[model samples]
Target: MTRFARTVAAVALTTALALTAGCGGSDSDADAGSDGKALKKVTYLTSFGNFGRDAYAWVAKDKGFFKDAGFDVTIRPGQGTGGVIPAIVGGQAQFGPIDLTGGLLNMGNGQAKDFVAVAAVQQHTMAAIATTEGNGISKPKDLEGKRLADTPGSVVRNLFPTYARLAGVDATKVKWVNGEAQTLMGTLAGGSVDGIGQFVVGKPTVEAVTKKKAVLLPYSAVIPDLYGNVLITSKKNAENDPESVRRFTAALLKGLEYSLGHTQEAAQILKRNVDTTNPAAAAAELELMAGYVTPKDGSGAVIGSLDSGRVAKSIRLLEDAGTLPKGMTPDQIIDFDLVPKG
Candidate 1:
């Protein structure tokens, strides 16, 4: 197995053991709901830290959406998108918010056959080429011949070729400088590298470090069909407890819609559960992310629903980028039936 695969396997094994130990008792031992009945215990794993990226899940828990759905949900922080699939497959988490590309690539590579996305949270690629204001890297083409801080396992770096193809640029000309996420923005600001392939969501991190606004060249600007975070589960979960999955999806979508309409309130709610050291920064990030939850294609405002056409396009893009095999189709990676309808 590759290093990434090995790391995921290790993390999944640890997570599964920890989770099993946490729920050693019977179902009746689970936390009681508002009705005094034992709520079904379920665990959720996120792709990253609680940096307002998972505001919806936080909001849902704080607002009692999961409780209303008869589930006592335990949210756990994940290592990354690469680890989330393994967490779910190994029965550590019943549901996970993961990167759609990573999930699809795993399916295409035959690493994960039972994993499928029930809901797409972000409608576009959150990855971008972030640079300082005066870096002279205004567009994708400008990245050619420039030194870019390439963080290990970054989705942006993995999909840089697809972005380059869409923007009509030669990705080979760009000089990649290996770095870590903690130091990428600092390195770029200190002139060690021209830019960094990062997520637009990290704008706050960059601004906090450099005390200057970061210029983001979003991958979605070039590849409009790309997707970001998604709600994924194993086929076994869907088959065994369809109602639980439905309730979870409905509650999550409700939380997403609530967050979109009440950004400040959502941030406050998120503060109660997650780390919001800078409330203003968290609120700002949530506001920017709200647009991602809104569908750009005039589809209904319901969150967590997949756009089949967009998924089809994304499949083709992944295939062309060599992430997915040529014969892989959307049906293998996505399960639209689990998304609750109005």
Candidate 2:
């Protein structure tokens, strides 16, 4: 079998679980009805803040796509992947928009056995390892032995270790620190850490605070496993509530389409959805996110469709780098049937 076929086969065979995540209880009442008709409630746990999920959150809520799709979608933000899977597995939510790599690792570790990936949101890694220009960490190699701050167990956490190893730098050589999204710039400014893994959206804030340019560490360059935020539903949902899964994914894809097509309007929506403390950061995030918007060909067909070939490459890279265990194939972990085939 081809490598891609092997991966598909592998993901199909795995009996993995998801990590149990915690979050603020969103509407403890399970029977909350939809706007017009009583539709099932679907919880979507986000790994980032309101600003991070602005694209989907605003477009879906403001555009009424979720309601139109017959879902009372509830949005809940999380600190990281630690809260996403549990929010779903523990019945706090029905879906999680989380880091693909962390979700897979959690599955392998048996924290959430029933979770399945439904759709991919962004097409690129929207994060970077920012450093001050004067700090002398100009190139990727300069990161060796530097104080690196990152949130442990986050997507960038898994990505950067592998990236460091790939860059010929020992992952153990650098002092890796756990950091929060709100306090990363402060950490860098205070010299607590020489470099930080920051989202592309926060680049402006980091630049403004430190007066230094950052060396972006694009995941695609080092890790073949660079997958954007993914929509995941429990295996129980996939089997028993396929309709809800379909509705959620369809609505989210609609939101993504609208977000990409209406840049000006989407930006405005983003502004309202996020807080005022980081308007510039939020705007920069949206602007930088433009680079990741999946484009349509001349035939008017979106190219955002799942690439099984890329998935296969990701599996191999993970396995080769020891991020994943040996013999873990794509099929055992992934369910392409949940994704739109056409």
Candidate 3:
């Protein structure tokens, strides 16, 4: 098995019995953690693996943010929407990050998350179809007859029909193949695919691997109202154990804010935890990601905050694209009372 699979399996095997991660108890009812504190024990999953983009979780654990929040968090690498959503809903993890738009699409497709979304991870959508210079794809129109690759349930691919309509590209003319998250950049580098579904901030990692300038057709350029990653937990957890949700969200946002501010140190921290990590590459990713994570709506909303109007617009866009069912509201996906307020 791949390291990610093996890691996830090992965690599932070990913690499945020990963890009461879902909405099984009250805030005061908890278990003893490693630090000898009666902190609630929960497993958390990052949307992707241990890339710099996901370092905030490790930061929360490393900097004692999780501990201070009165919890023992076991951080695990997730395999995108397909992998993470089921894990959170089925009780393997108590919290996780997911692309907000992708979650909506999943809900529309009849895959219920059992009521999720607690906070926003980024203020904007960073989904994009990225390619190298020599691939001859410079614009949306250029993507016609070109090949693309991404994991099966990636938002970049799931939301493509809407993006294509907005950008005036012929969505059906483009080709797609399945790829693992860890190998998408490699496929692009090897010229096996013209482009890969990637986040805008992934340019640094992509460029470093392909040794070429990365060209991007960012989904946000057309689908502006969509939020990026959003924090999610089971409905029972949010409704019954709200204090735990609130504390965990606060500590996680603290880590995300700190990681972005201290990019180099955050990268070093990731490297320290994951021996294969390259500090420079990780730092570069955080630097590019900073702008997206920053609130550009001029509403002065802090990090991890959500906006209602923007979310409604995203839903309308999805409905127009026929990927989403009608009457889907933001409240069904986001727990506004738990997110940061402006």
Candidate 4:
């Protein structure tokens, strides 16, 4: 099994042991319920294995937002967005914070029609094409005829066609080298591939592996309507447990706001939960991700607010790129009511 799978299994085992030992008391035992009852237990699955990327969730639990909301929340590391959908659908998790593109693609293709986005955490796409300093690849157009380390089923690979279209690059000519996620950066730094499509949040990791600064060409510059991480749950959960969903969204947004304002403290909180050995790097990653949770879009929307127009534009963009089927409206994929109001 992958390291992420092992970690998740370990956490599950520990939670089971704690529950068996009577240490895992319900929320009522801690006076966290609204009606003198135990708060509901909610499990959140992340999109990837990176602990640094999931700082908001860790901060929420650390700062007692979940407790205040009457929830005994547990956060687990995920293998990928692709695996996150099934976990939620199969009732393994109550919610998932995943790539919006993956959710949209799955819903649009009728793979998981019940899936809906509760709130958008990142306003813009963080995916970018990174090249080593002397690779001579500075722009999207430069990617033509060059080799890219592509991971199958990755959001970056899924959205590359749309990105290429918007950037006016000929996608047909680019050479894609299928590479494992763990080895992609090493392969790129070793001159095996000219560039790699990954999230800018991973810039520090890339630099550490390559021992050199990497140039980033953000996909958002080409596809401005693109979005990033989102809080997702099935329609059944939203409809059946509206109050619980509301509380969870509010608590998560509270954590996001705190993380945005206090990045260092948030990173420290995250470090305690995940295997992030480099405190400075974790802080840097959190700082870079903070601006994206709620961008300075003039819409006046708060942290967890979702703009209908932007959501529509994103759907249209995906449809145009053929990633999503035409006529698939945003309402079919996103439950706007689940987001907290201003």
Candidate 5:
């Protein structure tokens, strides 16, 4: 999913596809500001099709945070960060939900304009390998000498082999098979492939539908701590339209807090927003996402909290591992100016 998260299609404006109706508070909650004016509208583009961000959107609308913040917010789902950055830069949308790394890579390659992470939606990585039961694949190393399906350039497909290497498996031994998300689950259930990287949220759903237990290998358990989905916007947008971004971020974080606090209700809302074949599965996945939603208590709950030191560490790791180009600084990969210190 992270690979799909990374290689998502380029951002563009389209007919406003309202997945669920937006919820707002009463007139009192929408009380006028100093000038007694209404809120401004901010359009946001999401980075993936089944990304499951409806939780945040719904919570915000139902909670009146956006109305209080003076924003008429509209959310559009993008296939990947590729599509998101362009849309924001083109002013087709105000900001977008994107992978922080993918957004930075786009900026570094000059494929997109500079942007800031207004808030971190899911700090921990969520992609993982879900395997069929009775395959005797108990651990990460068991994936060796098996077929794994994935699209090329997917974060999971591209990184799994490396992750296997770290887990003491000869990544070359595993056969790479090309397949789509639908086919991957089918293949795994049908015994065509041993396993494939999938979102952990989808694992339980797959098990319920396929009647098979899947072992989800959390990447955080194997590799360096990495940031996942985030609220992103152009540097110009952030600097010139700070109020809009602030309103958007506040509403989004409020949504996150609500979703985290109320999973069962949130899951019901999520099932309605996601692909419909697996409502129970979607509900289960939304529950799984709570891990990504709320950071540990010791860890502050800054929506877009960033650590320059950690980023520098990742740069060194990627450079050493040949994943990132040399001489890339954290500043080149991150724009912390937009995210205020909590």
Candidate 6:
């Protein structure tokens, strides 16, 4: 062959290799500064599918919060505590959300240890059992003999037995069927399931999709201390790249504050990125969630502030409920030093 031909082949091979390497691996080589140079690429997963309840993450990306923090974020749908923890541990994703109660349960049983909670997204647990008007479900006891659809390993599904015991419902009587995160509400709308696992904020979306008023049974009503969603990252990232975690957590909470304050705009921002999101429904969900996003009392604590005392109490609550095993400390799951205080 000719020298020119060999040179051309070499150039093509080099170009192909560069492109492949760029897409395949994480780009964590640069300083975790907001200088906007050599942006570190990372993957984030929502607490669930692209529902309005998880809109803050999208808002962070769309509003340049992640970018401003020197991150090139790729957001994906999460399957809840069961799925997000493993993904972060396995290096498949860098940041995500998971229900704190579920996280505690996982940590208590020693099934999870490689991920840490960085920030609280919603101060109160929003897990609920939702159905339309015709579902004959006005209270938890009504859930008996009903079918519910939800993602496997979802917080709602994992914590239901505890919720059931507290609500005086028969856990064994209700049936839980596996459904994709994106399609759970649709399954409810189509009447394939009597109910769908949801957040209290999801009422508006369920109503819009079913064109019927939604009936909700919030777990918070019975299990008061559970936290809804908390931002998380792998232990390696938290230890080796503490600055990145701090920056990412700050940006995400900023977006959370912005989304709750400006619901319509936040909803439109979410709708722009995810076509399945309805602006009006998204806005309503955000509005419903506003009360749950901050300090429930008049104390004026910051949105993501978490108390070790409260978390310890939460652990005991789970232990009594038979969901979490004995002996899980707040330190096992939370990084108090990294948590936002101001």
lDDT of 6 by residue, 157-234 (tens): 989999999889899999999986666766887888999888887776677777899898889899888777888998
Give the C-alpha miss distance for residue 327 in model 1, angstroms: 1.1
Of 1 and 3, the candidate ranking higher by TM-score:
3
lDDT of each: 0.68, 0.60, 0.77, 0.69, 0.60, 0.76
TM-score of 4: 0.84
* Residue 92 of model 4, lDDT score: 86
- Using Cα atoms with residue i matched to residue i, what is each candidate's TM-score against the true structure? 0.82, 0.81, 0.88, 0.84, 0.77, 0.88
Q: What stretches of model 4 exceed 4 Å from their correct place?
A: 1-36, 177-187
Q: List the residue pairs that clash in candidate 1.
A: none
Preferred candidate (lDDT higher): 3 or 4: 3
lDDT of 3: 0.77
Q: Hey, what RMSD does candidate 5 come out at?
A: 5.8
Give per-residue CA lDDT, model 5, range 154-249, as digits (tens): 456655644676678788888888764334566666777777756556566557645777677766677747667777777787778777777678
In the range 1-342, model 1's lDDT, one tens digit per residue, is 000000011111222322211221222244776677778878887555454556667677777777778887777766456677888988988888877876776677776667778887887768788887887888888889898876444566767777788798998998877765334655776888888866676677567666777788888888877788789888899888887788888887787777767667766765555432345555666667766766655566466767777888888887877667788777777877886443
Candidate 5 weakest lDDT stretch, 10 residues: 4-13
The TM-score obtained by model 1 is 0.82
Q: Write the per-residue lDDT of candidate 4 for residues 1-342, one digit (tens) a residue.
A: 000000011111222212211122233247556455666788887555534556667677777778878877777765456767778878889887767877788777777666778888787777778777888888888889988975665677767888898899999998887765445666777898998867776677667667788788888888877778788887789889887888898888787777767766766765555442345555666667766776575777777777777888888888878778888777776788787666
Cα error, residue 239 of model 2, in Å, equals 1.6
Cα TM-score of candidate 2: 0.81
Which candidate ranks first by lDDT, i.e. highest? 3
Off by more than 4 A, model 2: 1-36, 109-112, 208-211, 277-280, 295-304
